[model samples]
Target: MVRELFNSIAKRYDLVNRLTTLGLDKRWRRKACEIALTYVDVKKPRILDVACGTGDMIMCMRKRLERRGIPAKFYGLDCSERMLEIAKKKVPFAELKVGNAEEILFPDGSFDLVSVAFGLRNFSDREKAIGEIHRVLKRRGILLILEFSRSESLLGKLTWFYTRSVVPIIGGILTGNREAYNHLWRSIETFPSPEELSMEFEKRGFKVLTMEWFFPRIAFVMVLEKV
Candidate 1:
């Protein structure tokens, strides 16, 4: 269902994202990339972006690292071929594969860093997915996640109202898939709170390095190291 939905909206995915987030998604992603870069001490870091939609995160990281002369190798994985197709066009240098997060196909210790932007909540089995991520990452490697979380502040309430009501309408008008956007809101609504999610990582042998919330606390970026 999720794959089909993403495939259906592949063409308008980026546009819908820009419109819905008022282009703040890009800034958030850039910020996440900058934070991820600070942990890359290796000469040629191997990075894997799980559920990389349209390749924006990979592309953003690539550009930033390139400017710093890091020459990192990028890999991306998504369940939707249509999404990967669009991602390929954006990050031509990235090696992308179609796969599930719970059962990543890569060998153990394959990457120095792994990232997921607004994708973890969609996984069929998030715990298993985290285990797979842990298996694939080099020891003490980083895992950076950018995802929406529940918020209770005034601004957060306003943001929730917008997501719950206005986002689906915008998504419907833009992508002709109101249900998909509805799922987006529902996922965010049901997802774990930032502190809870941090504990999940801790239970799985991950050390939380940082958990920073974007304005309003509606979304957050978590940085963890495999222990």
Candidate 2:
């Protein structure tokens, strides 16, 4: 279901994201990459992006690393072929493949860093995916997750209302797929809080390095290190 929904919106995925999030999605991706950069000590790091829709995260990380003259190899995995098609064009240099996060097709300790931006909630088995990520990351390697969070503040309530009621309408008007946007709200509504998600990672032998919340605390970027 998630794969089909993404495939349906692959053409307008970037545009709808920009419109609904007011382009802050790009900033969030950049922020995640920046956090990943700080912990990277290797001369040439190997990075893998799981559920790398349209390769936005890969592109952001590549550009930032290039600016600092840090060379790195990139790989991307996504379940939707249509989304991968768009991602290939965006990050042509990266090795992009069609695969599931729960069963990543990589050798043990294959990556220095693994990133999933706004994609964790869509995973059918998040815990399994976390274990697979842990299996593929070298000791002390980084895993960055940027995802929506449930907040109780007043601003958070307003943001929730907008996401639940207004976002679907805008997305429907733009993409002609209101059900897909509805699933977006449902996913965010049911996803675990930042604290809860951190605990999940911790249980999987990951130590939380940082938990940074965006405006209104409706979303967050979590940096974890495999222990």
Candidate 3:
């Protein structure tokens, strides 16, 4: 069901993101990549970007690597081939595949760094997926996760209302799938909080080393290291 939902909106994923965020998403993606880079040296980082829909985050990081003539061994994976097809265009130089995160096929310790941006909320078995992340990452490899956090401030409250309601309406009009947008909004509400995420990572032998906030209200980028 989720696969069909994402496939249905593959063509408009980029547009909906920009329109719904009012153009702030590009900066957000850049910040996500920036957060990912901090845990690993960018000159030659082996990155695995799971649930990499449309590949904006991978492309964002690749551009940073291009400045110094360093290339990233970036792999972008998603469950929806339709989305992967769209991502291929966005990240032409990187590997893009329709694959499940809970059963990553790579050999153990295959990647030096792993990251997921705004997609963890959709996982049906987040714990299993985290285990897969732990298994595929090299010992002490970095895990960069950019996810939605709760914002209790008045500004945050207002933003939340708009994001939950207005964003979906606009997204529905643009993509003809209001329910999909609503599901995205609901995912935020159901996702684990920062504290919960830290505890979960630690329970699975990962250490939370960096927790960054773009806004105190809800969105954050947390960087961890596999133990």
Candidate 4:
């Protein structure tokens, strides 16, 4: 279901993101990459990005690494082929595979860093997916996640309303698929809170390092380290 939904909207996925987030997602992705880069060794860092829609995270990290004169390997995994196809164009240097997040197909301790953006909430098995992420990371490896969380402030509430109403409509008009956009809103509303996600990370042998809200409290970036 999720794969089909993403495939349906793959053509306009980036557009919908820009429309929904008002282009602030690029800033958030940069921050996520920056946080992940802190733990990455400049010599030869191996990075994995799960559900890496359009490879924005990979591109962000790649640009940052290039600026610092560092060499790195990046792998992107996503279930949707169309999304991966688009990602391939954006990240020609990345090795992208069509794979499941719950069962990352890498050897143990294969990556120095792992990151996911706006994709966790759609996972059918969040715990298994997180465990797979932990399994693939080297000891003390860093994991960065960017996700939407329900906010309590008035501005957040207003933003939520706008997203709930506008996201599906704009997405539907662009993609000719309203149901997919509806699922997007529903998933965000049903996703667990930050406190709960922190506990989930701890259960999967990750210690919460830092958590910060961005985009007017509509979304968050979480940094965790494998214990």
Candidate 5:
């Protein structure tokens, strides 16, 4: 269902992101990549981006590393073929594959860093997907997740109102698919809080390095190291 929704919106995915996040998604992706950069130990790191829609995360990471003259190999995997199609054009140098996150096709301990940006909640089995991520990461490897969190504060509540109400309306008008955006909103509502997610990571054998909110506290970045 999620894959089909993404495939349906593949053409307008980037545009919708720009409109909904007010162009902050790029900044958020940069923050995630910057945080992951500190934990990367290899000169040519093996980076795997799961659910890498339109290759935004891959492109962000590559650009950051390249600016610092750090060489790295990039791979992107997503269940949506149309999304991968767009991603391939965006990052032609990176390897893009169509695959499920809950059952990653890579070998165990094959990656120095694994990233998923706003994609974890779309997974049907998040714990299993996280476990697969842990299995593919090398010892001391880092896992980066940039996802929506359940809001509680006053400011967060305002942001939640925008996300729950405004985003879907704008998305539907632009993409002509209101239901897809509805699914997105519902997913965010049901997603675990940052604290709960950190505990889940700990249970999966990851040492939670940092779990910090960016702004409005509606979205957060979680960094974990494989122990």
Candidate 6:
């Protein structure tokens, strides 16, 4: 259901990401990558961005490192063909693949850093995907996860309301696909809590580092490393 929905909305996915976040998604993406970089030495480290819809996260990560005059081998993977197509056009040099996150073809320890932004929740079996992420990462490799959070603050609750309400409306108005944005909001709500997700990482052998909270209580930048 979500696959077809995303494939249908792929053409506008990047635009929605840019608009719905008030362009703040870019900052979050940078933070996620920064977390990944901290765990890996990058004289040309191998990196992969899973569920890399439209490759915005990859682009942001690239910019984060390029500013430091460092180079890294970057790959972007997604199941949505349309999304990959758009991402390729935007990031011509990135290695993009269409594959399932839970059943990736990459060999063990293929990448020194793996990051997934707004993608893990879409997995029907998130644990399987978590295992795959663990498998693909080198020993002590960093896995950076960015997702929607459930906020506990009064101001955070207000932000969550906007994310749940106004963001979708704005998304619908801008993308002409209210149902798709609606699906995204529903996915965010149904996703696991940060603690639960952290536990999943621990179960997969990743030691938790830190999770940074954004306005919407559910939005977070979580960093972990393989033990």
In Å, residue 94's CA in model 3 sits off its true spot by: 0.7
Task: State how far residue 125 of model 1 sits from its true place (Å).
Answer: 0.4
- Pairs that collide in candidate 2 are none
User: Could you give me the TM-score of model 5 versus the true structure?
Assistant: 0.98
Question: Which residue segments of model 6 deviate by more than 4 Å?
Answer: none
Each prediction's RMSD over C-alphas, in Å, is: 0.7, 0.8, 1.5, 1.0, 0.8, 1.5
- Candidate 3 lDDT over 1-227, as tens digits, reads 77888999999999998887777778777886776676676457788999899998888878877865777799988998889988888788898778888889899998888888887888878899999999999998999888886677787787789889898898899989999999887888877778888999999979998887665355788889999
Which is better, 2 or 6, measured by lDDT? 2
- In model 3, residue pairs whose N, Cα or C atoms come closer than 3 Å (at least 3 residues apart or on different chains), thus clashing, are 149-218, 150-217, 151-217
lDDT of each: 0.93, 0.93, 0.84, 0.90, 0.91, 0.83
lDDT of 4 by residue, 67-175 (tens): 9999989999999999999999999999999999999999999999899999999888998999899999999998999999888889889888987898889889988
How well does model 3 score by local distance difference test? 0.84
**Which window of 10 residues has the lowest lDDT sum in candidate 4?**
33-42
Model 3, residue 48: distance off in Å is 0.7
Give me the displacement of residue 212 in model 2, in angstroms: 0.8
Model 3 spans > 4 angstroms off: none
Ranking by lDDT: 2, 1, 5, 4, 3, 6
Reference-based lDDT, residue 34, model 6:
75
- For lDDT, candidate 1 versus 4, the one ahead is 1
RMSD of candidate 3 to the truth, in angstroms, is 1.5
**Backbone clash tally for model 5?**
0
In candidate 3, position 102 carries an lDDT of 88
